[model samples]
Structures are given as structure tokens and as C-alpha cells.
Target: MRLKILLIAISLAAAVPASAQTSRFSPALLDRPDVKRALQSVDERATAIVDEWIHLVEIPAPSKKEQARAAYIRAEMQKLGLTDIRVDDMSNVSGVRKGSGGGPAVVFAAHMDTVFPEGTPIKVSREGDILRAPGVGDDTSNLMAVLEMFRALNRANIQTNGDLIFLASVQEELGLLGAKHWLETSGYKPDMFIAVDVGADDVWYGALRITQFKFFYTSPGAHTMESRGGPSPAKAVARGINALYNIPLPPIADGLGSFKLPVVNVGMLGGGTVFNAVPREAWFTVDLRSLDTPTQDRLTAAVTAAARNAANEEGVGFRVETQMGIDYTKAQPKQQRLDHPLVQTALAVANHFRKPGTPLIAPADVGSTDANIAVSMGIPAVAIGAVRERLPHRLEENADASSIVPGIKALISLAVALTTR
Candidate 1:
């Protein structure tokens, strides 16, 4: 089945039929003189975007706390004179670029939240040409990238047969809630969803296809001292852990992209009290993830079965719960390969600076971002980063200022290329 996007409740200059205002360049994008000029123009206007990027990065938008950042993006969209700017109830911020011809709605998005906590010091520091801060590259760069891309598209007067929607979305850090919300319920139907995140340059271009999970095990707790033979919810949890460890993991030779077996991190647990008493409640969160759905499904079943068996054998009540996960595996609107016109265009624009290669596409990064959500929804999505990496997610995270312009140039060029059609 094909996936569609929804865009709701916004004052449009005028509603143009989707067919009349949209265009889709299949096979590949045809390079035009305007595209070349726009790329050059983007390079020339790097400073303004870079300054703006740093400013936005300075605001901490952690997970559900994305209101401030969403407002920031909305203001930028409004400032750019974008029409029909709206911030949804879920806090997804979007702006539309009106088109003159029939064109599909191509979504352009950047995540609003970071993994850092609220009030984390977002103060950017300049050491030589490097820009340092907690959320500098993870997504702060992307937030500014989306806004600047719109600016360049406007400045170049590059009009496409498609309506380009710019989104500053929230809750990406938590199961891609914001992107999922837009994909599931919006007034605008999108033909494609382009997500800009983590500017890793060209060291890598592909994003991971992952299925995140939260497995829980529950059983009536028994006195550790009196019920030594029966199943202690904790023990069944242990068996679940063992089952997760033994769960069949995808082989490295699968060629279907790298995979991570259920990480099986026991996030939290509850049961029992002090003074030698048998507790009646126990629960724990299990994290499972992989590139393939079957792999994740099999693993989930194995853990459940293990928990169930242990509970039955020990004579106690047991159940499993799914905290959350992507509904599907691959990012939606498939055909998001590196050779896709969009990816290729992004590559061309990035060439003025760097090339994403193997290390950046390392097996470790498995769609742990908003890009994952888009991919699952059948949208063509890719995540990128700027200024390189070191100390990301740490108190010492940083990016080079000299490299910032190049990164900005890359985003502008890619945006211009994608929208030029």
C-alpha cells in the first residue's frame, strides 16, 4: 500500500489542485541552469544561515519540551514570508511554498527536540573555527538547515510544480511522535517526505532501518524467602533476558543493511519491599531493536514465550506489554536509495565540502532518529549532520565554525535541488 501525508487547518492563499501544482521527477532529476545558479547562490549566502543556525541550536528542546523550538521555527518560516504557516497540536511546525504548476507535496523536515535535558547549556563557544555545544550537530544544525533551505529556494526564485512543506517537528526523540502525527493526520497529503538530520557530511548517506521496542514482563510476586521454588517475577524477567540474548539475530552477511539484536537493556524494575517480605508486583522495561521486522518480531515472541513459560512453571501470573515501536520497518515512500535524485542532489551539493562514507554509515547508527519514522511510513528520508563529530551527547559536544558554512552550503544546495523540479 502507498503512504499519504495529511495537512490540516491553515489559511491558504488559495487551494491549488494537487495535480495542477505538483511534479514528480522519477528515474532522476534533470539538472537545470537554475539549479546550478541556486547552488552557487547558496554558497554565497552561507554566513546569514550559519549565524541563524547557532542561535537556534542554543535553545534546548528536549523531547516533549519542544514548544520553544517549534515557536522559533514558526517565526523563521513566517519571517521568510512562507504562506500558511501552522503549528499543530502535537507541536509540528510547517510552512508552505506556493507553486504555480501541478505538483506533489514534498515534505521538508527537521526535528525540534534533542536528547539533552531541558535547560542544558546550549551556549555555543568558538575555539578557533569550531562551534561547541550540547545539541550543536545532532539536530540543531538540521533545524537551521530546513529554515535556510526555504530561504534559498525563495531567494533563487526557484519554483517547483510541487508544494514544499517545511516542518520543525517535535517528539522525534520519543518514537518519532511528531513526524508520525503529521504522517498519520494532517490536511496535506505528501508524495514524499524529506527529513534533514545529523549532518554527517558524505562519510555516509544512508540511514538505518530499525524497529525499536520495549518488552515488559509481569507476574505475581512471591516471598523470596517462602516461595523459593516458584517463579519470582524477577527470575522470569531473567529468563526473558536470556531469551533475548539467545534470540536469533540477523547475520552481518544478510546485505539487507546492518542489524542490532535486541539490545535487551532492562531500563526499570519494581517489586518487593524491605524487611523480608514477598512482594506481589514486578515489572521491567526491555529494549529490543533490529533492521528487520521479522528479526524483531521473532525476538519479541521469544522473550514473551520465555516469560510465559517461566511464569507457568513457577505458578504465577505473567504478561507482556509493548511500550512502543515503529508500525513498519523501512521508511515510507520507499525508493530512498543513495542514487535517488534527492540523495544524488544532496551528494552533489555536499561535494563542495565532504562525502559521507563507511564510518558515518557505521553499523552502530540504526535509525535512532526521525528519519527512521519517515522511512517506516514509506517516505524517502535521510539524516545528515554538520561540523563532524566528537563528544556528541556529552557535555563536551562541539562542531567547527569554519566547517559550519560548508554544512550550510550543503543543505542549501540540496534543498534547492530537491525543490527546483
Candidate 2:
């Protein structure tokens, strides 16, 4: 009798469809009335947000020179009625939204600086639905998204359970110096962090470890005839570059939890002036990256040793220095775990906004972002952008205008969900 009952139950269960299963927490958030209103508001303001993007991009905000953009963001945040607004020494502008219910604090930040140097033309061109300009999509889209989210939240009058801090960070293109200084100096410690950058549909939970080194070679200069026995700084720099490029890299792991292989590249090299003269000084920059921190450290050591040895061979002064002329070279922090609530929430919310059978982001597609500072300090953090962009760090960078609405919607939903938690 018991066996018959169990078999009958199993047969009945098999008749149920996949759609009948319980909805995920992330997808269910969309069903709330307030969330729906917020999404609609974002959609309504999408065009205005693009206008804001063009305006912001036109402002010159290169790394370490974000004063103009910072002031602009500060004024906008003030207009949005954010409290305790402040700009730090690094030009990191931030504002706070106090929650009615006491819960964790969450920060949403987008960098204000662009990879383009000062004086780069940021004029926008419209071709059909696409908007083109220097730094248009790399981060201008994200900065606008954050601004619009703040506006929508106020317009919709949606109150969260936790405090929300909105930020327009500076110096992100200069190795995340702005974020690092702000994190160390600011007394506010949020439970979760979301860094807006790069892409809206795609998410990055894991922050890749990075180490940049600038090798400077120096020697007494002489003409080719007089410098036959003298050390050559240029030759030393070349030897170091060759050794770094030839260093063997481990294969990327394909396991469920493992990350991809490390990478090392010499991004810039500068040396001699005249062809017939032995240059007195030469310099080269190396950017080393790894998903694993220990591996990154090991590889950094190897590169440093290689450069120093090469310098010794050429009898030139080879000093290991930082790329930014800082007292110590900066390194990327540890990655966020896939299972962390912040990361999982971001992934689920991203998938919720995408079409069926489309993967918005994955744990393995990690990159360096401002969230690296938070993640390094054991804080839950994830990096996202306002929309899909093309030709980042180039003059032709652009983003899909249609994606902005959904992108901002996802950001709002994610913020609400994290705050409620």
C-alpha cells in the first residue's frame, strides 16, 4: 500500500511543468510594485540620461585631474538632495541616502576619470541610435547611470532598509588610487559595494590581481665610438623586456571554481634620443595580472629579478619603481568568492534582466576595477556598468542607447535587493 502511494505521487509530480517551480528571489524582486515603478521611471528618463552622458564626457576628467567632473557631479548630487556630500583630496565625490529602516550600508560608485588625456575632444556624434565620442562608453555611460538611479529613486520615492551611498570616484584610470585613498580615509564602512564600470549587462565579481612595475635604467652617456666599453641602458631595457615576455605562464584552470591563467605585458618603453649616442636613461613599464594573489606575487618577483639581472649584465643603474611614482607599487586585491551573497545577487539580478538562454556575466570574466579596494579589505563588492559598450579606451567608444534603461533598472533592483537583505 505504501509503495503504491509513493509511485502514484511520483507519477503525479512528473506531470508538473518546469514553469510551475518557485521563482528565484532575484526575478521575484521585479514583481514588486515599487520595483516596477522604478524600472518604468528609468525607462522614461533614458534619453535624459544619455544627454547627461554627453555633457559629462565633454568635461575633461583625466586621471588625477578630475576636479571639473567632480564639481559637476557634486552639484548634481546636491540637486538630487543627497546628504553629507563631500569631495576628498583625491577628488572622490560622494553622497549618502539615509534609509528608514536600519540595515546594512551599501555603496554604488562609478569612476569619473577617463583613460583619455586632457584636451581629448569629447564631442558626441549621433549616427542612428548610436552615440560616439572619446570616453563615451568606457565609463561615461556608467557615471550617468548612477546619477539617473539616484534621480529615479527620489522621483519614485522608494525607501530602502539600508543607507545608500552614491559616489563618483576619481583616479580610477591611474591604478585605482582614488578608491584606495578614499577607502583608507573615509570612516564609513559599507556592508556591500557595487562599482559601476565597463558594461551594464556584464558583471564582474572577481577582481583580478595586478602589479605594475616601472624599470628605469641609467648610465653615463657617450657617443657610439666612446661608449664601446660603457654600459648601455637601452640594451638593458630590451633584455628585461625580452625576459619578461618569455617567462612561462601556467595554464588556466578549467575547474568549476578555478580562474584563468596570468598575463604579463610591457605596455610602454622609452629610451634614447639620438641614434648615434648611447642613451643615459631608459625606462619600461610592465603590467602583470593574475586571478590568484600568490601567483601574482610570484610572477611579480620573477619579473623584478629578471629586470635586475638584465641591468647587472649591462652595468647600468636599474631601479625597481612604481608606475605612478608612489612610495610603494600597488597590487590588486583578492577576488570575491562566487558564492558570496553580493556576487550571487549581482549575477542573479543580471540574468533576470537578460533574455532567456542569454548569459550576462560569469565569475571567470574578472578584471581590475575600483571594487578591488573593497574586496581586498574583506568587503563584499562587485563591478558592473550601465550598458554594453564597444571600443573601450578608444576614440570610437560607444554604447547601445536601448540597453541604458534595462541597465539602470538592473542597478536599482540590485541596490534595493541588497539593501533589503
Candidate 3:
């Protein structure tokens, strides 16, 4: 270990003799013949692993209720020879593959729980090349992929300088509660955090995202026939929504501001007893997201300001409630930069295996993801697809069965590159 660290230090401090990329970023050709053989061996086991994942998926694990699934994952990890594996307080299951040097820790996490409630039929069946099920692509496939990746690494005895941590998180559908808890509780802090709960084999590279909210207002309630008085929360919410609608969002975020052009949505609204009574209180949800802190902050302020203004002008109590608890904000803030070596290394792997010169897609998504937490909470993170595809998270969500191999190759290559140096 000491020797490995010294070597890494020397390498980092000076250029290599124009030679090999660090073990992490080595070209697509497997460095060790034995590693290639191991990967080949995994070929026969793919169906079995897929079967196991399907079996695990059938065991219903709604948000916050992942004990059974987590327990299953723990047993699987133990079977795979990982050490220090356990389910954490937030029901996140973790196991570590410790390495040989004084290098960074890397985390790859997938949520165990799905949005479906308990008793949802999670039966798996092959619909041609696609795997059709509620949580199959949203996460089950990734969880299974983690096992396959680790198994392949172990088979090849591919060693690393950095430690690898695998996590089966909980309640991602419920706002990343499991991630929030694990980040708070994990004794080890990772230099790289990878959230593997996305669909498609592509990625959003070097982008960090945040979610903020707005409140809608309605006038105090009175008989519709008589007490129609103040501005209604619903109307206030509508006005804010309109204001948001009028404000055009940029195709790309302005990089250095406290606010971005607001992209807003009024998702929900309710506060009334009868058709005849004007609602005394009306509350609605507004979601705003941005790629940079300044823009995100600016948008949040606009949403709040809009809600307040709308309420005051309408003579109704206009109050906005922000999403509270862990998912909304990080326990700590992460830095913004695109030059992390790991990010670069992953890009190298992507470019190597994927079609040449295809630029990494940094398209910002409005949806909130667990990756948002990793970035917001100080982990240099990138979210990507292992098995790329379309129709993810829809009723037809699936990974291209053939693409799984390339995806595996990409993941393995990226890991090798980052962990070696």
C-alpha cells in the first residue's frame, strides 16, 4: 500500500514517460488477459443475475420500507465477498471492496425502494428485448448491474488504489431520504459519488442541479354567495404560474449568477370544503431547478417573490412552504467545476467505448435525482447510463439487452481509470 501511494504521488506530481493512462483510464483493451477471461466467464452468468434481480424486484419495497429488499441485498453482497456490509439507519445497504493504496473512496449507489406501494405486482417477464415492470429500469436493473460489475471485477482480480463502495439506498422516490441519511451516517466520505438510478446508456456530465419551490395563495374562505373577498391562493398560484410561464428559460444556464431564468410548475393545489365556499386557505407546489447556484438562488427568490406579491395584492394570506428535510438541501454544499480528474477519466472511457467525438450531453433536466444530492453535498459527481436506451421510467422502460455489454465495459473502464491513478 505504501509503495502504491508513493507511486501515485510521483505520477501525479510529474508526467508519465508519455506512457499508459493510469490503470483507471487505460484504453478499452483489458490490461490483464485474466481480467478479460473473467469478464468472459460472466457471459454465462448474465441470465442468472438478471433472474435474481427480477426475483428481488418482485419483493415489494415502497419508499421507506426497504428492509426486505435491503436484507436480500446484504446477503447477496456477503455472497459476493464484500466486507463490512450492512443496512444503515435509513435502510441503505452498503458493502465495500477495499483497495491497496491511500487513494480516494468512490461510491456507486442505487435506491432499493420503488415508487410503487407494497403489494404492487412486480413480476418480471421478457417483453422481447425489454424488461417490463414498475421499477425494473428506474432502479432494479442498475442494482443488478452493480452486482454484475462487482462480480466481474472480482473474477478478474482487478485491484484498485481507491476503495469502492456499493450502496442500495432507500426512499429515492420519497425525496432521497435514504441518501440523505447515508451521507449523514457513513463513516467514509467518497471522492467520487455515482448515482446509478437513471435510464438510457447516456449521461449528464459535469452538471450539478438543485430544486427549490413556491407557494400559491387563495383568499380567506367565505360563502361564495356572500363572502367572496380576498385573492384566492389558487388564483395567486395561477398568477405566479403565469409569471413563470412568461419568463423564458434559457437553453443553457448562465454560469455565474445567483439566479437563472425561472422554469416553474404548479404541481398541486387544494384547500376547500365545498363548491359554495371560497377556500380560506389554498396551497400549491411550485418546482424550480437550475444548474448553477446563482441561477437556482435567483429563481427561488423569484418564485417566493411572486407568491408573496400575488397574495398581498389579492388580500389573501400568501405563504410559501419550501421542501424541508434532507432532499431539499445538502448537509453541505459542493463545489462547481468540470475538471475533476475522475470526471475527465469517465469522459475518456465514454468516448473510447462510444462513437468517436460524440460530445458528452450536459443537458439539464427539470426532474430531481439522487445525483443532485451527491453534487450539492460536496461530492464531485456525474450521472450516466450504463445500459443506454430510450423510454426509461415510462411504462415501457427497458435497457437494450445487447448494450448491456458495452455499458459494462464503459463502467469497468471508468472505474479502472479513476481508481488506478
Best by TM-score: 2
2 or 3, greater by TM-score: 2
Prediction RMSDs, each to the true structure:
9.9, 5.3, 6.7
What tens digits encode model 2's per-residue C-alpha lDDT throughout 1-421? 9999999999888786322332124577777887788888877776788787788888888888889999999999899899999998778999998888777798998999999988888898888778888888878888988888888888878888899999889888888888878888988888888898857656676667778898999988899889887789999998999988888887865532333458888989998899999998999999888766677778988999999999999899979785532221243333324556677777777777764465545544465788877777777778877787788888888877777778888788878887874
Worst 10 residues of 3 by lDDT: 328-337
For this target, which candidate reaches the highest lDDT against the unseen true structure?
A: 2
lDDT of each: 0.62, 0.79, 0.66
Query: Per-residue CA lDDT of candidate 3, range 1-421, in tens?
Result: 9999999999886774211332246654565675576567567676776677678768888888888888888998998899999877787999998889877888878788877767766777676666667777777777777767777888788888888888889988767778777877787788888777664334443333445454746564677678655456656666666766666565654432223433576666666777887777767677665555566666766667766777776677766567732333432323232445655565556656664454543323322556667666667776655655445445555555555565666666666666765
Cα shift from native, residue 30, model 1 (Å): 14
Q: Which of candidates 1 and 2 reaches a greater TM-score? A: 2
Residue 376 of model 1, lDDT score: 64
Shift of residue 334 alpha carbon in model 2, Å: 8.3
- Against the correct fold, how does model 1 do in TM-score? 0.75
